[model samples]
Structures are given as C-alpha cells and as structure tokens.
Target chain A: MADITKSRTDTPTLWVERVHPAVWALGLVMLFMPAFANGFWLFQVFGWTFILGMIALSLMFLAGYGGMVSLIQMTVAALGGYGVAILGPSGVAQISLGLPWWLYVPLAIAIAALFATLVGALAVRTEGIYTIMITLAMASAFFYFTRQNYGIFNGYSGFNLVVPPQLFGVDWRQPVPFYYLTLGCAALAYAAVVYVARSPFGLALQGTRDNPRRMAALGFNVTAHRIAAYTFAGAIAAVGGILLVWQNAQIAPGTAGLPAVFDILVIAVVGGLRRPSGAFVGAFIYVLLRTFSPDVLTAFGLSNERFKMLIGFGFLAMVVFSPDGVLGLWDRWRARAGRRDPLTGKERG
Target chain B: MDGTNAMTSRLGAVSTGSALELRGVTKMFGALAAISDVTLTVRPGERRAVLGSNGAGKTTLFNCVTGDFLPTSGTIRLFGEDVTTFPAHERIRRGLRRTYQISLLFTGLSVADNVYLACRGVSRGRFSLLRPRRGDPLLTRSAELVEAVRLTAARDRLVSELSYGQQRQLEIALALAGAPRFILFDEPAAGLSPTERAELVAILTGLPSHIGFIIIEHDMDVALRVAESVTMMHNGRVFKEGTPAEIETDPEVQELYLGGGHG
Candidate 1:
C-alpha cells in the first residue's frame, strides 16, 4: 500500500501493492455505509457532504495548484444545476427542453465549464486579491442575473422537482442509492484531481503559480494554463452542482449567492488547501457542525439562529491556531509522536 | 524517433536566416533611458559577448531582446520574422531561450521536474492531463538534460536543496531545453567558484555549432574564452564591436573597462 505514494524515481512495483491499506478500508466503509446508517445520515448528512466537498475540491484545485483563490466555484455549480433544470425535463415545463438524461448531463457540465473558462480568461489577467475580487464580482453578477431574468434561468423561482433520471431500475433520489451515487462521483473527482496534479498540465500550472515569469520564459503560456485550470475545476464543480440539484430536487438564485460562494472558500481553507483530501475533510466537519450545532445551541439555552456564530468562531479558531486547518494539526501531532522514543517516552534526538 | 526527426526538420527549416537581429532598439523607463538605439545582430551559429560595467544597460538590452520589456522604439527579428511585439512566451516558442541573472527556479519542485517542465513547455500537449509513462520522450530528454548539466545525482531532490552552483547549472539546463536556435545567457558564471566557472565555460563552448548565443558576463576570462566576438556598451550605447583579441588589446577598452582590473 505504501508503494502508491512512492516517488517517481522509484522502481515500478506491483499494482496490487500500490494502494494504501487505509484507502481500501475507507472504500469498504463508504460502500457499506448504507447497510448500517439510516436514510437521514445517508441522504441529508453524507450526501450533502460529498456534494459540497466536490465543489470545495474544485476551489481547492484552483487555489492549491494554480494559486488563484477563485470564489466563483459555487456560482459555477449553480449554473450547472440550472443547465440540467432548463435543458432537461423539470417541473418548470415552460423552460425544460425534455432532453435525455445523457444529453443534459454533459451539456450542463460543458456549460458550467465554459462559464468558468470565460470567467478565468478575465480573472487570470489580475494577480492576488484582484483575482478574488473579480471572481466574487462575477459570482454576484450571476446570482443577480439568475434572480431577475425570467426567460432562460426561470427567474427567482428557479426550478423544483429536478430529480435525477431513473437509471438501472432504481430511484436514484432514494437515500441509499443517492449516497452511492454521490460517493462514486466524489471518489472519481478526487482521484482525477490527484492524478492530474502530476500531469504535464498540472505541473505547469503549479509552475505558473510559483513563478509566472519563469514559466513564460520557459515557453509556457501561463495565462492559457490558468484559464484551462479554471475550466477543469469548473467541470468538477458542475458535476457537484448537478448532484446538489438532484439531491434537493430544486435550486434557486440563493443556491449561488455571495454567502454560498464564500462558504466553499471557507470549507476548502478550513480543510487545508495543501492537499485534495483536505476539502472532503473540511466538508465532513462542516456538515457535522451544521447538522448538530443547532441542537447543541438549543440545549445550551442559546437560540438556534446563533449557529452561524458558533461556526464563525470555529473557523476563526482554526485560522488563528492552525492556518492549514485540521490536516496541519494532525501532521504536527504525527511528527511529534514520531520523534518520541516508543518505550522510554523520551525524545529520540 | 518521430520527435527527434521533427526537431531536426524544424531546425533545418530555420537554418537560413540570422539567429537574432535587433535594429535601433530603444527602451525607456519614464524619465530614464535604460537602453537607447542599441542595434545588434548575431548570425547563425555565432558566439558573441556583450561586455559592460554596471548601469551600462546590458541587462536591459537582454530584456528587450527577450521581450521581457517591449522596446519603446525599434524592430526585432528572429529567423527573419518580425517579433518586436511578441510576448515573452511567443518569442520563446520561436526558439529564443534565456537564463536569468538572479537564478529564477521552481524551488519546491524536484530538479528533474523543473527540467521536465521546460521540455514540456515547448512541446505539444502542454495541457495534457495524462502523466508521462516510463519511456516518455520528454522524461528521457529531461533526464538527459540533467545529466548534461551534471546534476543527475540530485535529480530527485527539491531544487531548494541544491547548492548555489547546482542551481545555476539547473538554470542553464532549462534554457537548453527544446530546439533552441538562440539563447541569451545573463551572467552564466556569476558568483561561481573557479571549478564551476570552468564547467560553465565548457557548457557554453561545447554547444552545437548551429546554436548561436549572446552571453552577458562580468568575468572577462569566461566571456573572452567562449565568445568569438564582443560588443562593448557604455551608458546605453554601443561602445565597440570586435573580436575578443581586439577588445582585449584595444587601448580605449583597456582604459575604460579592463583598466578597472576586471578578470
């Protein structure tokens, strides 16, 4: 299992020994989760976690690898959801084009990716805080346009009953089936990001991030690489968006509002932007907190509306204490434990 | 096999014209003229050196030629094609390569990764999502480049872990990537030990005959040893152009530049 993380210089090993044991264990647990957990846990908790994690993972791809902290990922996801709603059959008979599931799915992802690429074309020209401002501005524009325009977007009412197609003779909206669906998509998206991180495109994107001038001198179109990164990330976010709309069977302008956009950024940051897995970890933590915090707040004689305050404080604490988030804290603990003598309980060095 | 042939064909096709030609190139920084009316030309396979003291606009001249800064006035051509308005990467894709004076490198990446990126930059599939397999030509080329720069032992090490001289060697390896017809080396031997300086000179002089280059150096020993011709600059102007022997023996050059006891 450890061979999977081996450096590129290492000799090739057997494929069976490549993956880590922990990964196999996690896979088994996720696969069998429906057997033990109830519908609420599968549908409301894990389903939402996987969906939000996928969106946050897109932002992580852009921010971590490309050094562009874009806040438009949520909006891109919303647009994807809207694409499915408007292009395929939905409750909104006025707009639904009644396209087949296969057709609408790809079209939705493509539209979202194209939107991201266009936004990236505009955003990559600027540096640092300006990128955040530009992406946020675009996200705001998309939200308002969706809210006001009644034609293509269906206006503020958005769309409802936008369910996933019935494939394999199973109702995909069922909690168990939906869990597997979201889990499969999230795993694939995670693997794709991890695999692409080492590809030529990914390496060059990181190169541009570290030193754009040097990359340009080396004959790389830094701007093109960045724009392409946004497109890739957008596709991932769009997939998540489609799942989200199906999970709730609805979507609105509020789906991609400013707060939601910022939420994805917060999720990625709180998970640790250094690694792809961090987004999922952050999303899981956020889902748990958002689900259980209201109960805890009410138990403590505080209004459930103050759940936001608790989340804000938790985020602040994470940033102030461990800027890299939960992963950094885990890493520090592991490093400390590694340095201690096992039997003597003393420092090794 | 096919990649090598394509490179050869590209090289053969562009073999006719001058490697680099700049006419009346001038660059200004608001109220200051960094380089003014600097006209220079290097023929195919020519080895030339630009010698000047600090503030002589030598770096600025390299910047203009590399498209790091667009000249306020003048026309630049590479392989007989006008490229005065081309971006840095566009010029680079046209076979113009450059090494920085300040050691610009991807410190977090491995040495091989850095060279691999340089090779991948000019090649097709710059946006490939597929990782290179074991027998990938770019990987082979990158490994060969690392070996050429004598850093194969540190190939897997992070660039930040390399010694200063090793970093400079890596810089040269990057510029040598792809089918470069012309290279602008900005002080390739700067701050090197005598042994490293010898290595730098060997690398510069051992390049193929079809590849021309302009070297900017404060080390006269290095500059004169590798370069056949010399262009001296003073106060943003061309002071003299001659062979290394002529520049070494010219009375005015001795009085103005070498008299300062530069080696």
Candidate 2:
C-alpha cells in the first residue's frame, strides 16, 4: 500500500543506495585530485569550473524546474561580487567600506537576492520569450550601469586585489584550499537544488510551469511562486559570484557583461538543464575546451582567436544532435545498450 | 433603529445566505455579451444543474463565478462575502472550487504528485523547502484523494498515461481537495464512457450534504439524476428554472431545449 502511494518519478530513497557507483568514483577522484594534479589544474581549471557551475546550476534550477529561462543569473552573481568588493576592504579604498568578512558576505547575498526578487516580479508578469527578453534587458542595463557609475561601482577600472580573507591561519586563496572551498560550495549548491526539486515548493513550481491556470485553481499563487523561485535561484548565483570575485582577485563590469551572461546559459544548455549534475558536467567541458582550445588551435596553425568559433560550433553540435544536452546523449546511449525484455531478461528485437 | 435592523440582517446573511449568489453578472467580449444580466442563487447544500446548449453561456457563467474571467459588471457573493474582484486562488482559498471543462492537469507529474500538489496548494507551508516525511498528513490526504478518485492502481503513472475517463476523475479529485463549501463542475461528464459516467454520477451524489455544487453537463441522464433543481439557459439568458420533473415536463423547455434533441 505504501509503495502504491509513492510516485516512481520522485520517490526519495536512501542516499547511499541511490547514488550510482560511477558517481562515487567521480566523487573520490574530485576529492583526491590535489594529490595528482598541479596548482594550475587545481586552481585555474577546477576552481573556475566550480564557480561557473554554481551559477549555471542556478540557471538550470529556474529553467528546468520553473520553466523560466532567465539571463539575469550572471548579473546577479556579478552584483554579489560587487557587493563584496564594495563592502569589504579592497584596492579601491575610495569605494570599499572595509567591513568585516562575516558582515559583507550575507549583505552581498541579500542584496543580490533582493534584486533577483524584484526582477522576478517584473519578469514573471510576462512569459516565454518575454521573460528572456526582460531578464536580458535588465542584465544589459546592469552591465552599463556598473561600467558608467563611478560613485558606488568605481567605473570601468573596477576594484582589484579583492582577495578572500585568511581565516584560521590558512591562506584560503592557495590553489589547493581554493579548489576545496569552491568544490564544497558547488557540491552544496548542487545538493540544495536536487533536494528542493522534490520539495512541495519545487513540485508546485513544476505544476505552475505545466499549467498556471490549473495551479491557480488548485489554490496556488502562481506569480508568488514564480517570484520566490527567482529569489532562491538568485541566492545560489550570488554565492557563485562572491567566490568568483575571490578567484579572480578582482571585481569588474566585464565579469557580468553580455558575453559572460550568454556563456552561463550556454554552459547550462550544453550540460543539460534537466538535472543539477549537468551544470558541473557542462562547466567541466567548457573549462576544458576554453583552457586547451587556444593551444590546439595554435598547434593546428590556426589563429588562437578562433577558439570562440570552436566553442560556438561545439555548442551548435550539442544543440542540434542532443538538444537535451550531453546528458540526453548519454541517456539515449545507455537505453540502447541496456535494452531487454523485463520479464524474460533477454535482449529484445 | 435602522442600524439595528441592518446588523440583524447582516448576521442573518452569515447564517442563512445562499452558498453562491450572482446579481446582474454581465461578461462581454468586444461587442458580444457572452452572458448578460445573469442573476443566480443557490441555497446551502443545494444540488443544481445548469443546462444549456452550445453558445448558451454555461461555461462563461462558470468562469465568472470562479473568477477565471471577472464579470464585466456585477456582484458575486460566496457564502455571503462579496468576491467579485477576488483572484481565482483567493476565491479557491475561500472554500470555492472548480474543475475545467477541458482537462487541465499536469501531464509530466505522476498521479500521486498531481494530487499532492492540489492538497498542498490549499494547505499551509506551500513554499516549504523540506520534503514530506513518511506518513505526512498531507501526503496521507493526497493518497486518500487518489484512492477516492479510484486511481490508486495508477497512482505512480503520469497523467499523460491515464485514460480520458481517469483524467476526468482526477479533475474531480482536484476540485474535492481542501474543505470545499461550494463547487463548480463544468461539463464533468463530457466524453466519458457509459461506465465512467455512472461512476461520475456516484461520486457527485456521494459528496457530503453540506457541500453544494452546480454542475453543467450535456448528458441529461447524469445531470437530471444528480441535480434536484435545473436552470435552463438560452442565448446567454436564464429561460427557465424548475425542478427536474417540472423542467422535463415544461412545454416551452421541451420546444427550445429538450425537444431540440439535447436530451
């Protein structure tokens, strides 16, 4: 009777038993990566991947579960970064408030989340293409505002040397420590998204996405749910943004420019928007390509500037062949490989 | 002296007012009035049927009362509270429920998930981040609703996989979620098989006596069996109102609707 009541699609199970062996192996590899890899691989490659992955995961959370494709995630992240730089001590003494780390971190996340909630209230009023357009427009506005405003933003020559504080006699910016910090944060973000996907709020979000009118009839405030989703996604993106400022040791308008905003969307789509893990997978692929494509292009006697073209082609190929992203490709392959008659346990024709 | 009478009348309304009241409700689309000057009243626990032909504004009337589309002009009272301007969800929270004429279910979600969402919508903690524990009250309630709709065997299946009749049953279960004081069922029996229609009739007749409902059904058999009083509409206006027997026997009703082959 209990089994009959449970939904096969969303039933919660013991975490240890539900996770695949391959995932366990991957986790072990990530955990022990510092022993095998050098500082560059640990800090530059993996650190960047984790930060970008968290931001993209927020996008996946909204687009996959909420049916809202918001381009403002990257902007939210940048705002978070800017909050840290402006509130905490930085090279730009004129703008930096020189506040304590604990004080600035929560304040930064709150400001970004509040901005996202406001944007969500406006964006959810329209839907589909209009949502994308409105968020993109807001993102563009933020970019220009930061670039032009010297009062609070410090203008085009934004803050530099905005490093993470040394806590407990540990240099957090060290390559090994930074990798673990980002990996831990990214893992938490991923888990939060996965856990929330099965919560009542998440279920209702999917309901509103599928049928807003029916959801309203079911007594859900559809607009409020949608706006709340943006708030949650915004908080996740803000965390990524703070880490990103620490990673680069700087905060600039270019960090959340149009190109950067588009890159996060591309990463999410290429990874697959259906699951949280896809964000990390797509981020890893993007980081690998970005890091090596210049060398590969140069080796082939081609201009390194064509790396963007290469990435573009890769994105196009993924969309055309597996619009669900790399995960879709993997799923189809697994299905074909494992096809059999359930009753007979034999290969089916 | 006048204030005392007004207070007595207001208190009287709270105790004995109709379950649903529409006074001069009018809805217009451009130059066309879908339903104009429609006044209706249903007492507490009253089982009523709104019978109308196509374009007779039965659906339009349901939409107005449910707050799907606000009436262009007029007052709507739900259990004696003026709710003409309330949003759909607000009205639903106020013990009013409705089922769409066309099925409006979440096809991607499982049957249990669908019912769970309905149960969660009206209850508190709508935005809870925590998943329901085993044997949560709301989960148990949703399970009961699924069982009540006779979809227990298919509880794990998606709505898209359910048969047409099963989807219709799910629609009723969604409307029955929360403690509904009044329900508006729009063509609840449309496209149902004979067996399914009987099951629907049983469900409708089995509802608690305190919970009244207004049903708009094309099937006279099911409608007449379940509804004690029938309201007939023609050209968006109420042409007649009488008991099932009276409406069935009325010569004018026979010429315009029953004799026109709708029965």
Candidate 3:
C-alpha cells in the first residue's frame, strides 16, 4: 500500500529566507558607501574588504559545507593574481606577456580551478588534520618556488603596475568603479555559494561530509563530490585574487606566503564557517582592524606594528567567546527570540 | 569488455530478480579468515536470515556480499551478473542496497531529508544543479517511503533526536528508497525494546515478497520467526541451511549453534 501517513517539509523560519532584511540593509549600506567615503577609505577599506571577503568565502564553502579545511585558498588566489599580472602589462619587463585581458582572465580562473581539483583529489582521501597539512605544505612549497625562481615571479619585488583596464568608456581603476567591480564580484560569489548549497550536488557533498561511508553506500560518489566542491571554491578564489591584483597594482610571493594563507583562515573562522555571509562579516572586521588599529596604537604611544598583537587578541577572543564566529552568536540570539521547540541552535543555510 | 558484456546482459537468459549466489567466498584480514570459503545462494522472492553468534563472521559475510570489502577469493553474482570486484556504490546502483549493523545515517539532517536522499540515490538527476532539494521532482516518491516506514509524523525532526527504534526504521526506509530488488540488513533487530522488536518483525515479514532480503540478526527467536529459511554459521562457515521448521529441530544445528547457546 502507498503512504497513508501524513507527510511534511521542515520550513525554515521565513524571516531568515532569501530577500532577508539583513541582506537588504547590508546592500543599502554598500550602495551608499562610495558616495559617503573618501578615495582612501573606498579603495583601502571597502574594496579590500570585498576582495578578501570573496577569497575567505571560497575557503568557507569548502570548510563549512564540505567539512574540509584547506590552507591553500590564499595561495590559489595569488595564482590568479600572478596570471593577471603576467598575461598583461606589469612593472616587470618581458615577464608581462602583453596579452589581452579577455585571453588571460578565464585562463587564470581555469588554471586555479584545475589545480584545486587535483589537490582535492589527493586530499579528500585523508581526513581533518591530514588535509590541512597537505594544503599547507603545498601552499608553502608554492611560496618558496615563486621566491626562488625569480624569472617569472621577479624575485622578492614581484610584479607591479598590474592596473585595471579602462573599458566601455569608464576608467575602472578609479575609486568608484573599482569599488563597484569588487562589490559586484563579491555579490556574485556570495549568491553562487547560496544557490549551490541548495543544489542536488551541494546536498550530496554535505551528505558526504556528514557520513562518507553511508553516502557512498547510497550510490553517491563521495570523492567526486568533494573534488567538484573544491573546483567551484577555486573559481571563487580566483576571481577574488584577480580583484586583489587590480586593487593593489601588484602581486608577490609574500601574497601567497604563510601569513596571507593563515589570515584568510582566521577571517573565515571569526565570521562564521557555517554561513556564506559570515565570510564578508569576518573580512570586514579583519580589514577594519588592519586599517585602524595602527592609528589606535600610535595614539597610545605604542609602535603601529603592535597592531598585529591586537589582531591576534581579537582572533583569540572570537575563538573563545564564540567558537562559530559572529554569525553563530547572531544565530543563538535569533534562536532565543524565535522560541523554537528544540533550541539546538542554527541549522544554518 | 564493453559492448559484449552489455549485449550478453541484455540478450542472455539472465534473471532480473532478487537473486544472489556466492561461490567459495572468503575474506581475510591479514591471517584471520573473517569469512572462510563460504558458499550460499538465495532464490528470488525468498525470505532468508543468517544466524550466527558473536565473532562468527556473519557481519564479515554481509560486508563481502555488499562490496564493503573485497572477498579474498570468490565470485559474487547478483541477479546473474558477476560482481565480485564491484564497489559498494556500484553494487547499490545495480539494485542491491544494504543497511549497516550500527545504523549509519546523516544524523545532522532531518528525517525527511534522509528519505529524500534515498529517493535521489536511484534517480538520474542526483547530480543536477540549478534545482532545489526541497521540491525534488521525486518528492512524491520520497514521501511514500517515509509513509511506508511510518516516519511521516516525525519527518521534519532531526535524525539525532529519534529513538533507536525509529533510527532502525529510517534505515529500512533508506534501503527501500533505492527501489532495490535485494536488500541486506545487518543486525536489524539488535537494539530495540521487546515491543519494538515485535513491531519490526511484523514489518519485516509484512513487506512485499517481490523485494527479497537477507537479514543478519543474532536473535534466534526473532530471526527464525521472521525468516522462511535459515542459514546457521559457526566459526566463519555455514554449518547448516534449511527451512525454519527443519532448522528448529535439527540435532547438529542444536549441538553446534542453536542448542548450545541461542539455538
């Protein structure tokens, strides 16, 4: 006999759904920021935040939804930055290939994504710490390789003059256009992550994350799903990396080193590893501290470099007080307000 | 290796039914033979149970058949196709699905989602993007599985919140979701209250005969009652195979397995 029993779907609270008030509020602030903020603030603060946020969000997609922690995300982004610089005009002499932007941008993204798939193929077989270590090793190796090679990488000086091209009657390198460019890419990355999570493939990846053995038994290819997730994350980071080069007008081995790689991890963890929006929140906090902490320290007669200490303290405080980051704290507040029957807290989207 | 195998499978006198045959199946972890040169066959639409005590290699045999572990040396034919080296997922895609002894599930997900994934397991659009998981086209089919397992009331509840009995029921729903012709259930009635055990036995025996099953249960009373035929294993080998009435009265079966401890 067919199902005579009552059937139902668990509807997540409607307020938290798409077109959320919080998203609207954020969008409104971002839209007005270019008009309100000076050029220094626009390019250094907000544009940088959007770029780093996109890169961090790429890591979040893998770490949060797929249960994988990759330390190679920043390094992967640098690969895109290097591609953009090498394929176009740069401070380095002949290393810049002088190719058209169209020829190089997609090629850069494809290379990063392919590399991510290869890394995922090898790493997905191992769990937790092993995955992290492998990614770290690969990232470290790439950093060293770029530093020593010098021919393409231009040694410690790296590449400079990696400017944004003026296209469609607008100078994109200008503060307003650059801010819009970064904001648009970040929004696309954010929306893509949200949509993919609800897709069947994303669902299957989560299932694999929850229980690999069971997912495999259920006719899902666990390894393939993980690699696919990595590839998608790679594309996202590549976009962010290209944006970073345009914003800085430079790319270097330092951009792909241990410090940069760890910074992205800290950002993703402090925002909320479970939510796509958390990446932006974490990046905003990070960029604000890096930009303003020096002035705050100098006012207290401490050397501005002590700002690193403040950042470290901020990271510790976040980890200890809110293990899942700022978004997690927000989720708890919402749970209490919602008064759901079981307050196990935030089955986040 | 490609077309010939496909053509032979398509045109050959192969039985498209819940049938399985194991020839000299053996599984060794280093030197220990978990399942030692055991051979058995189940006819289509027959009710069967594997009876063995703790450490008797019953689970190992189940693992080998389900492709969780490759047999040391043997041939496994499911529905008349040789699949000795096939992986667990491949075996499942071929209509032989199974449930674990420990009741493995995506505990973080809701009960409805667990059933929904099972529906997707056998579907062609399992990897499709740009489609939401909530309105999965096969939602109607998933609902039926939830209802069949009598989990519709608690469908929206998180799986971690369910009682042990309910988790076992969800396990059955997962196995059934694939629309598998043959299902292997490992220790299905192991951890349940007496009433729950009775209800499970009733559910197991009540399932349609078209879907055959091999249940590995240690409870002799429950296993014998629900199964039409029985295979008793001792020290990793089949000691006896017979009808329930015949096994319940055999002297050797009693001395070796049923009588000595639970026989």
RMSD of each: 2.1, 4.4, 4.9
- Candidate 1 regions with alpha-carbon error over 4 angstroms: A1-9, B1-16, B260-263
lDDT of 3 by residue, A131-158 (tens): 9999999999999999988778787889
Tens digits of per-residue lDDT, candidate 3, B1-263, equal: 13324533563377645389999999999999888889999987777998877888988998888787899998999888898998787777767788889989988777877887776766666677664434545677778888887888888787899998899999989998755778898988878899888888888888778778888987877888888899988888998899988988999877766666653
* Model 3: share of real contacts kept: 0.59
Q: Chain B of candidate 2 versus the native chain B: what TM-score?
A: 0.93
What fraction of correct interface contacts does each candidate retain? 0.75, 0.82, 0.59
Candidate ranking (lDDT, best to worst): 1, 2, 3
| Candidate 2 local lDDT, B42-137, one digit each (tens) | 998899999988999999999998888999998999878888999998888777889989999998788888999998887888899998887788
iRMSD computed for candidate 1 = 3.1
Candidate 3 shows a clash count of 2
- TM-score of each candidate? 0.96, 0.95, 0.91
| DockQ of each candidate relative to the true complex | 0.60, 0.55, 0.47
* Model 1: pairs clashing at backbone N, Cα or C within 3 Å: B220-B263
Q: Please give, as one word, the docking class of candidate 1.
A: medium
**Candidate 1's residue-wise lDDT over B171-242, tens digit each?**
999999987889999999999999999999999989999899999999989999999999999999999999
